[model samples]
Target: MLHEIGHNLNLDHANSEKGKEYGDLSGAMGHLYASETHPMMCFNAANTFDDLEWYIDRQKIIYKSSYFWEGDLVGVAEYDLCRTGKYVAIKIPKGTYSSRGRYDYYISFNRKILFNSGTMEGGDQVLVHKRYTKSPSKSYLMKKLRSGESYSFQSMTVHVQSISTNTSPGIATVRVTKETPAPVKPVTKHPTSNPTPVPTPGLTPGSTPDPTLNRTLGPTLVPTLGLTLETMLEPTLRPTLGPMERLVEHPMKKPLECSPQQLLKPSVTLQGPLSGKIKHSKSSKAKRPLQHPAYPWNKHSKTSKTKSSLNHPVNFGLENPVWHPVKCNDMLERSCINNPLFFLKVKGRRRNCAWLGRKKWRANRYCKKSNKSRKMVCRECCNSCRICTECSKICSNIKY
Candidate 1:
């Protein structure tokens, strides 16, 4: 019953004697007095009671320390949470509910009670039912005790068969409790990447249980690689070429769809069969900056053309390479260039420099090699998996 109640309170197992999440029971002191006897909160997994009536048709109230044998409990214990110095005691009165097993739990009296009741599928060896609900059982401790120390007490032991059994309506009796607080774990805060734990003294002023503090955590805080809807978030970002290598070095036979940066990052090693400046042939038609034929867009066509007038930048590349409207499918390609990460990169012609864009383009800037060279480049490309010419890889000529 106590365990179920703790579950409702979002508490995990109290038997874990050592952990960093919730305060550690092994290292912490108790809040309850030594005289207030109830079974300490550690023995819930066993069956040591004979009051089966409390689970079937009656309520049975048990006190602290009274249930356990002399050495069953250790020194002082406290509720890891609530910090109250109290030992929780519980009871499920006879006839209150029909259960296949005992319905009593051990806990701190002052701490909130999360009570629960249910029946288990009985078995000849033993019967166990997981808690489904919890409510306060009402008897918790209240007195002076430190968070980690224990009080002295005379040890008491009992034999199960020696005790009188309440064989009335048929339900097993199980009593479990703790004398010392058990350790707890940290919980993750929603929305934020950090986790929070109770504050402690002398924790270095700014030192906190929150992981998100100081070191900023993020998914770049804003969109970078893929298409992301505009958001209210205003976050600064950094650029790295790692994500690109992951794509280019793909072990599978499939081709890689790359961002301009990814393509450039790998070229840094230039260790592949193909190395040095990627040269383009002055042969086949250069991949029109805008591959679509309907709308021949170039650096000059950035401004929109309405019914009124046109504010054009003067498309100077091809006397007429043909213009085409941007397509929905090509958005990924556009995004690679327009990404915040792309803009943040230092623009220049340094080794492994990522191409942001071109201010001025020429008709023969990048063209496919002759079908013959292409055949050779293609053979090399298939084996080396690197670009030497337009036809070698990144074929803008392939209309999407």
Candidate 2:
């Protein structure tokens, strides 16, 4: 009766580390076999209780610890599971979230007291359980730790320092620490060619020249080979080139002589790979710049045509109960059930149309969207539809 009540309250079966359903002997949800005898049956796992978010917020039974991160050095905190109104359990959240989009672990101490009188295996140790956002009612056993024992997961490590049996209610002290990855060394590259010092006409030898006072008259052209053409043209003694080496020259051997204003103006001739001429107007009328075909802001670009999150239609709950049906035979894909998690929070907390028991009218609004969720729930709520003939036998028992 208690277990069935737990299910009605949205609590799913707790699984053991061995992957057995209802195998977590520490909780009331677990069944006792003919050979096993546990007189003291405790409440459900901490994660299962946490799944009832409203209960956790209202009861205020556990102490919610700050999030754990890499390189964090946490102090010891004591927890008493047998009593409430104080810190009965400690919930430790890591910096990471599980695939189900919830904190991965819940730490709680389990000790026999009151209705929890049975001496279960690993009862004295602190138990860790996993939480899933999709199934808040379900929790999986992860680890059982004793004094001086530790459990390492991801970047965080939890250590049990001591278990005190001397107190009326057994207390367990735990410490959390995070291991940060070692820093990587940056690679330093040596410059292929150093900038030539521009000599100031009036500066004395061995004295540093002011860079602002000795700026270059114009930009210097450096080739891909790292040789400055202007510096190479100087009247200095040159080294003899090897037989394997050949000197390359610019395609345009003659330099263009232009006024200072002409150098700042945009050139009409397209250079390099383009090799084209652009039409320029003598009038002061400015023309819009040409955009690349793949540019995101271009109206005709493919990227601009992609649907954005804002374009999705809003879902306002149904005013009346109505059904819209589709021919299952027309569907190219087989009628298959989606993942249990796929329907979770589809319309925000407790607003899921398929899961809504009495308020099914709300489902009418959810099915209006042209998405997978519409098909998954609309067939049942809006219209009575039969399974497709192709996969009828295999999918007969499965619900959308």
Candidate 3:
């Protein structure tokens, strides 16, 4: 019953984790699950007494003595308080022994409560609801009440007669009285007359009329004679090409041919007695300047010939070093020759030709003779595999 009364007072459940679980035993609108004491709205089984009835009776007395009475006088009671468009005043006294839900009572008055109490402390003030129909619950803290203050609402005037703070439960005596309507003065009616119609002069026949007034309302035709001639005589805007266009239009000039005599050759004048002996000194040095001992192509000394020299011989000329085989190993003997040109062609086949031996020679021969056969043979022989001294001899025996 108390819980229902709390709902009537517009009281909501006190929200908390414990309130949601065990019950909000502290507030009047709390639930009674597993709680020993029964607050106003709690559902405890121990609350079997007629205490709620007594509480309702006391509430009725308080309502009759306080702002609820003013609300009743303004045709706003507890049941019809939430009804739209109804306005009433509710007076709440300080230190009143009511339920813990004061917010519920404030909400019940809706916007009727005048929260503005100028120059008065909020704790010491009284709450008086007036003729406002909207809910001030959203912003009720902005206004407060003071003692001996009178607020007029529509035809009713709510006056705070006296506030007795000396009493145990402070009594704020408020009086609600209907305001008397002011007498209105009589308004006198005057007589109105219609004036005579003024005459407008009509256009006389065969008389010149004003051009401004006689002008046609349609759009005026503009003379295109001068405009068309000016547009036709206007110069055409020709697009200009950028520097890149000139660069692309003309082809670049060929580099000038440089003769052997005019070319900047490094001075190779021999300072020693062996000067005229090296005829092609420039070509020889330029072709193979850094001669490694392992490169048989560069090392042309007869005594320094490699072990493969037994199977293939190299010819050293004054101008260029060449390869010539006196006796070829395996089936390659028939294909072997002492051609100086062929020797020159296959001279620097590979940088590591001395170490690679016959495998390198076969790959170089295939590359020169048959371009198609060179692809497979060169790929197999000249790959990542290193020709060891033992493998070089074994490869020399294999016919390509």
Candidate 4:
């Protein structure tokens, strides 16, 4: 994964096919698996040293140069190269020119890259060169400086002591010295107060009072006192008319009369355009009672009676006075065989069959015999069975 990532970062395979044979794993490229030791390129799960040196050398030479500079008594005319984290070189000329005034020229360096260009050289000492020119444009001519190179112009000379291309492009120290001084200016003192005092109009020694001030400040004592005295001497006056009589009134007009002929004529009723017919009140119309559908249990009651009659002892020849066994085929018969107490007992009391007293002949014949046994088999043989009744009466004379 790391090898593929190195390839994405624009790193190519090494030239040699050997592994870590000679303490240098920088040439282990194009192989399937690299040695587990050092960092290298083009190997699976391997760490080689070649990638580290390649990045370090690339960052050393990769830098952007600026065209602007700053210094005291010097106007810097340079370009701003917008890049950081790399080494760079800046060239500043030392000369004097008079555009606004006479300004001495020199170079000032700092750690921060103002306008993106600052001191990017990574070394303990940086060498500078001096170039002399009669014109300001000629002073800007700067060439690339190599390691251990020296340049001289007029009385000033610059020497390249050493250049470093391997150090990180971080904070570095810079040296600045005064190459020229600025011209001096003359000084003058200003007066503290005015020489002559101007006089104010009303406040002056013999000036007359203004006419506008006299009109605003004059008093009206006589007219105010005369009006108050006149009101006190005046007599009270009484009203001659009442409130109702004093109101203005107009004469009343006679109302117009109507004839009987006009009253006998029919008045036409106004109808809306969308009205279909007039709606009558609910009290004015006859109402009928609402009917509901019959219940499901009522419709099944007749069918249930026929099924119950099939289980009666009369159909099984129990009416001959001798008890006979009825077949346990229907649901009531099966219920009687399975649960005898359901038909023979009512809650806790034993009673005769429910149909014993209802039918005239069966009620008179077995009304007394139905109390002998509270079993459903006795009721089935006696021909007095009643399945839908609440009574628990059974025929006691019959055997199970």
Residue pairs of candidate 3 with colliding backbone atoms: 67-91, 89-129, 112-130, 115-143, 115-144, 116-143, 116-144, 117-144
Give one digit per residue, the lDDT tens place, for model 2 in 1-400. Answer: 5565567776778778766888787776665444444455655455334655423421222122443422111111122233333344455543342223354567666765556656365576777777554564456778988888888766556778888766755666776555533557977697568776986587566877576966568755754566568878889886533221311111123222322222112434424212332332333233422221111122432333342222222111122111111122111111111212212222233232232222222332122122222222323221122122222111222232
lDDT at 272, model 3: 32
Give candidate 4's root-mean-square deviation (CA, Å).
Answer: 38.1
- Sort by TM-score, top down from the best: 2, 3, 1, 4
Candidate with the greatest TM-score versus the true structure:
2
TM-score of each: 0.16, 0.36, 0.19, 0.14
Prediction 3 global C-alpha lDDT: 0.30
Model 2 CA deviation exceeding 4 Å by range: 32-38, 52-86, 93-103, 180-400
Q: What TM-score quantifies how close candidate 1 is to the native fold?
A: 0.16
Error of 2 at 316 (Å): 88
Runs of candidate 3 with Cα error greater than 4 angstroms are 1-10, 13-55, 58-122, 128-143, 151-156, 180-400
Model 1 residue 392 lDDT score: 32
TM-score of 2: 0.36
Candidate 4 C-alpha lDDT tens digits along 1-400: 4435546644444222122222212212232245454332222111111223322221221012322222111101111221343223332332312223221222111122222132223112332312222321111112223344434333223344334323333222222222332335756587567765866556558777676744465786666634566677887676333212211110112221322122111221213211222222233222221110111012323323222222233211111222222222121221221122323222233343332322111222222334342222222312222221112222123322
lDDT of candidate 1 over 168-256, digit per residue (tens): 11222223322333446888677675665866666466655776658656656554765455543556576542332333322234454
> Which structure is stronger by lDDT: 1 or 3?
3
Best lDDT among the predictions, by candidate number: 2
Off by over 4 Å in 1: 1-101, 104-325, 328-400
